[model samples]
Target: MDLITLTGLRVRGNHGVFDFERRDGQDFVIDVELGLDLRPAAHSDDVADTVHYGELATRLAEIVAGPPVDLIETLAQRLVDACLADSRVARARVTVHKPQAPIPLTFTDVSVTMTGTR
Candidate 1:
C-alpha cells in the first residue's frame, strides 16, 4: 500500500487528568500515516481521486481543539479513526505528542501512538 504521511501538526488542546490542564490547555503535536493505494489519484491527477489532506488536516485540528480527553492514547485512537473515515485508507497510525506534560523531572516529550485498520 502507498503511504500518505502528515507530521508536526500542532494544536492547542485541553486534554489531561489535571484540572489545570483542562483550564489552561497545552499544545499537542500529532503525526498521522495513512496506508492507501495511490494509483487512482496518480492516474486521474485529481484531488478527488485521493484523500484530501488539507481537509483531513482541518478535521484533525478540530478534533484536537474540540474537547477534553484524559489520555493521549484516546486522542491517538480518535485520530486513527478520523483517518480511516476515508474509504481509501486501509490503515492508519497516529501519534499524539504532549510536550508540556505535568512532570517533575526533565523530559523531552511524552506521547502515545495508536494504529487502526478498516
Candidate 2:
C-alpha cells in the first residue's frame, strides 16, 4: 500500500496526570502515517481521489489542541481514530510526543504510538 506521512505536527494541549499539567498546557508533537492505495489519485490526478493532507492536518491540530486527556496513549488513539475517519485511509499509525513531561530526570522526550486499521 502507498503511504502518506505527516510529521512534526506541533500543538499546545493540556493532557497529563498532574493538575498543573492540566492547568498549564504543553507542546505536543504528532506524527501520522496513512496507508492507502494511490492508484486512483495517481490516475485521476485529482485532489478528491486522495486524502487532503492539508485538511487532515488541520483536523489533527484541532484534536491535539481541543481536549485534555490523561495520557499520551489516549492522545495517540484519538489521532488514529481521526485518521481512519478519512475513508481513503485503510490504515493509520499515530505517534504522540510529550516533550515537557513531568519527569524528574532529564530526557529528550516521552511518547506513545498506536496503529489502527479499517
Candidate 3:
C-alpha cells in the first residue's frame, strides 16, 4: 500500500475529563497516515483517483472541534474511522496530541495513537 501522511494539524477542542478543561478548551494536535493504492492517481494525475487530503483535513478538524470526549483515545479512533471511510484507504493511523494536559508535573506533551484497517 502507498502512504499519504498529514501531520501537525492543530485545532482547538473542548475534550477532557475535567470541567475546567471542557469550559476553557485546549488545542489538540493531530497526525494522520493513510495507506492505499496510489498508482492510479500517480498514473492519471487526477485527484479523483485517490483520497483528497484537503477535504480529509477539514473533516478531521471538524471531528476534533466537534464534541467533547473525555479521552484522546476516542478522538483518535474517530479520526481513524473517518480515514477508513474512504473506499480507497486500506489502513489508517491517527495520533491525537494534548500538549496542555492537566498533569501536575511538567511534560512536553501527551498523546494517543490508534490504527485501524478495513
Q: Evaluated with lDDT, which candidate comes out highest?
A: 3
Greater TM-score among 1 and 2 belongs to 1
lDDT of 1 by residue, 1-118 (tens): 9999999999999999999999999999999999999999999999999999899999999999998999989888888999999999999999999999999999999999899998
Ranking by lDDT: 3, 1, 2
TM per prediction: 0.98, 0.97, 0.98
State the lDDT of candidate 3 residue by residue for 9-107, as single tens digits: 999999999999999999999999999999999999999999999999999999999989999999999999999999899999999999999999999
For candidate 3, give the lDDT of residue 115: 97
Model 3's TM-score against the true structure: 0.98
lDDT of each: 0.95, 0.94, 0.96
Error of 3 at 113 (Å): 0.4
Superposed Cα deviation of residue 1, candidate 3 (Å): 1.2
Q: What local lDDT does model 1 show for residue 103?
A: 100
Error of 2 at 103 (Å): 0.3
